[model samples]
Target: MYTLYIANKNYSSWSLRPWIMMRELELLFEEKLMPFGNGSNWDSFRKFAPAGKVPCLHDGESVMWDSLAIIEYLADRHRGVWPEDAKAKIWARCAAAEMHSGFTNLRSTCPMHVGLRIRLKAISPELQAELDRLNELWCEGLNRFGGPFLAGEKFTAVDAFFAPVVFRIQTYGLSMNTQASAYVKRMLALPTMQQWQTEALREKWREQGHEKAVLAAGDVLEDKRMQP
Candidate 1:
């Protein structure tokens, strides 16, 4: 079985993808939790990954870093990580890439933290524009694909790619159109996602200042609070 090295379950968004994908695909793998923040954890993570990142997959002797690479590698080993339809496959790739490479403001402003909650304020106008574009993307994908997910029916890698975004959206209680809200609901309903969240909720590990994002969701952020 493949071995996955990951950071804290509560805050590591990248760690969630392939970890959950493996479960959804029903592929058995060994899970090693390296929980971030300790010097030793960084040392171990860097030893396995040249980039010193979490969610590193050890396939026998070969190690792969980055969530998308891990997902693609597993998809190669087992099908159904991506869509079966050719056209849908292309769009799925596009959506995944867009999610992987873009969304700077959303990521920077809203770090993923599972259990804690806080209020936020004074979001940048630029970030608000980014959020608007993201809403449009979510709306279009749901409309075209007829989704409870981004690519419609099945929970493909595309969904995994944006799962972190889903958490961010929910945590922030970001305003979304009907379609986007429905898509968020679909993602939340996934068994694998529930498992991830359950694990996250039970985590004792904490990151300084990340609690605010989680708390922000349930509470109202003042108009002046912003992450600098």
Candidate 2:
């Protein structure tokens, strides 16, 4: 049996990657949520997570850490986790890897928070550059691969990697071009993504560090998305 250990649904972008991939690919796995900053949970998480990070996957005796690593491991074991076509697969992997390593500015400036809505006081030039690159990348993939999803007609790991970006954009009310905005809407509409968002809303645990950073940047207003 495959088991996935994750952190808070509201704040852990890394955790969201593999969780969404497994769910969208219809892979059956036991989910273990470890709320970080909790002493007991952190200690328990360290027992399995090699880097002491969340989103670790346990497959029998093997423990896989890192979101991209876990996704690649599952893709090797199962079909449809990634695109089948060689060219499409290459582009998808490139995009996913880029997401894994790049976009530090966007990640630092606009953290993922499904449960909170914040209006950013400003978008720095660095963040704007990252957003522009992201929009271009998404547009290129959709145009090149002919997608309703990132890689093709069906959802793949590429989409899963960017799932948190969808939440980031929504939470901060960031703007993108027409195609990018449409893609974000499509991602938000996925049943698996919706499930994560609902669970995130129900989670009361907050990472004080993340909360402080977000509060310092912008005002936390009512969740307009939830308001009737």
Candidate 3:
């Protein structure tokens, strides 16, 4: 059996990637949730993760860390983790890789907290540029490969890569074009996404640093999901 180690669902965007991928693919694996905060969790995490990060996969004797690397490893073992067509596969890989590497401004300015609904006081010029680029990338993939998902009608690793972005947009009430908005709705409505959000809302341990930054930027919006 495979074992997947992850951090807090509400704040660890990196951990969500392989998680949603495995869940959506209906793969069976044991989940080890390690909430981040102090020295003890860090020490435990380091034993399984060489980089001292969450979302590490333990497949028997072999341990694989890094979200993208874990996804690729699962893809090799399972079908539909990525698109099947060669051309579509290439396009999906490019978009996923781009997401894996770029978009620092958005990631930094608007950290994802699935349990909170926040309204940013201001969207910085750099952040807006990143959002614009993200919209273009989404549109390009949707139009190029045909709609309903990033690469096609079926969900792929590209979609999993961008899943955290959808959460970021919804949680912070960020704006997007019509197509992008529709896509976000579809992503959020996914059963796996819903499951993650529900689990996140139930988490009691809040990352004090993230909460402080978000509260300073804007007020937390009232929502039923925010209620315990």
Candidate 4:
């Protein structure tokens, strides 16, 4: 059995990546939720996660501290972590890797807040460049590999990597090209996505740090979260 450590679904974008991938892969595992604590969770998370990050995976005595590492670890042991087709597998890895490292602007400007619908005051140039790249990359994958998942017919790691972006788009009501929009709709419609959002809404703990980013991004139109 594997144990996965995570943080708040509403705010932890990195945590969502592997957490959703594991669920979609139907890999049996236990989830440990450690919501962001007051001040830094650095000391606390360092207990189980080496670098004090969520989405840490414990496979018996061995531990994988990074999301991409865990994804690859599962890919080694599981059958469908990445696409099986040669070209598709290559593309999936590259796309997922790109997502792992790139898109800093989107990640920072539009932090994941699943329970709120926000209307942004403005999209900064940095964010706009990233968004343009995002749409282009997504369209390239969908056109080359065929949809409803990036890199193929299956919802593999690439889709999981972009899952948080789906929520961000939903939160800020961001626009994309037609194909990318359809991809977002498809991803949002996933059963796993629905489950993740529902749990996120039910969470009442509001970490001020995450809230600060939300306010910086835009006006909160609707908050689906439970009231205090």
Candidate 5:
């Protein structure tokens, strides 16, 4: 069985990537949650994560550390990590890669905090540009591949990669094109996403770093998590 080491579901956006994908695919694996700054042993995480990061996957002897790497590893061993169609697969990879490497503005200005709803202090020009880009890309994929998912009919790795963004969008109420907004609603309504958020709300350990970053970005309108 694969052993997936993650961190707090409330703030660990990277961790959420592989976890939600694995859960949606019904892949069996043991979860190791190493929450940030709450007795999170870097040495223990680095033992498998190598970079002291979450979302590390240990598949027997093979240790995969980065979220994107974990997804690719699953794609190699599993059948449905990506789309079945060749064109869809390629587009999905590109979209996932784009999400991984780009969108620094959105990633920084609006970090994923599933437990809180915040009215952002400001959306800088850079962040607005990135948000516009997000709408454009999502619309393109939805238009190109038909309805339901980024690549095609099924929810593949591409959708999983953007799962955190769904929460980020919710936390900030970031606007998007109508179709893209509908896509966000569909993703948010998923049973697995609901499960993740529910679990995230149940976490009592609050990381000050995440909290500080959040308040620095905006005013917290609501906090659904149980207090630490």
Candidate 6:
């Protein structure tokens, strides 16, 4: 059995990537939740992950850190984690790579918080530019693939990679284009997504200094499609 070391499911966006992929693939594993930055055994996580980060994967003796690397590793070991078509594979790789490298502004500004929401004081000009670029990326993916997912009919690694971004867009109360909004809706409808949301709602750990920024009192939107 594989062992996945993750932070609180509520705020760990990177953690979600592999967890969702594993759930979607139906891979059985044990999950160890370590609250981010501080907790009872926070320092011990570094022994498992070189970078002292959560979302570390332990497969027997081998250890893989970083979300995208984990996804690629899993796909290498478990073939269908990503789509198999030649073109779909290429575009999926591109989408994942772009997400892995870009979006600094969005990430820095709108961190992922499961039970929290924060309205931005000012959507930075750079962040707005990044949003435009993301809109273009989503539009391109939708135009090429048509309906449902980024790479057309199937939800590939590309979708998994962008999944957190969808959450961030909503969490920060960010605006979206038609394609982006549609994609967010589709992601919200995933059973795995609803499962995560439900679990997050039940978690009680709260990181002190980060709480105000992460979870805003007024940002709770209407309960839409997530499973409870």
By TM-score, the best candidate is 4
Candidate 3 has its poorest 10 consecutive residues by lDDT at 219-228
Residues 1-228, candidate 3: write the lDDT tens digits.
899999999888999999999999888899999888843566777988998889899999999999999999998899999999898899999999999999998888888788778888889999999999999999998998897999998999999999999999998899999999999999999999999999988887767776776687677885434543
Model 2 lDDT-worst window of ten:
219-228
Judged by lDDT against the true structure, how good is candidate 3?
A: 0.90
Best-fitting candidate, scored by lDDT: 4
Off by over 4 Å in 6: 39-42, 212-228
Clashing residue pairs in candidate 6, if any?
116-215, 117-216
Better of 2 and 4 by TM-score: 4
What is candidate 5's lDDT per residue for 107-165, written digit by digit as tens?
99998899999999989999999999999888888888896999888889999999999
Evaluation by TM-score, superior candidate among 2 and 5: 5
Q: Mind giving the per-residue lDDT tens digits that candidate 4 earns over 163-209?
A: 99999999999999999999999999999999999999999899998
Q: How accurate locally, in lDDT, is each candidate?
A: 0.77, 0.89, 0.90, 0.92, 0.91, 0.80
Clashing pairs in 4: none
Candidate 6 residue lDDT tens string, 1-228: 889988777778889989988988889999988875544454677778988887899999989999988998898898777777787778888988999898988877777776655567777799999999989888887888775788878777888888888887767778998778988988988999989887877777766645555443335454332343
- Candidate 1 per-residue C-alpha lDDT over 1-228 given as tens digits, one digit per residue, 9 for 90 to 100: 899988787789999888877888898899998877644455667877878888899999888999889988987888899988787778888888888898887887778865544345656787788878878877777677777667777888988888887877766667777777777887888888888887787776665545554554346443222222
- Evaluated at residue 170, the lDDT of candidate 1 is 66
Where is model 4 more than 4 Å wrong at Cα? none
- Give the Cα error of residue 59 in candidate 5, in Å: 1.0
Clashes of 1: 5
Q: Clashing residue pairs in candidate 3, if any?
A: none
User: Could you tell me how far off, in angstroms, the CA of residue 228 lies in candidate 2 after the best superposition?
Assistant: 21
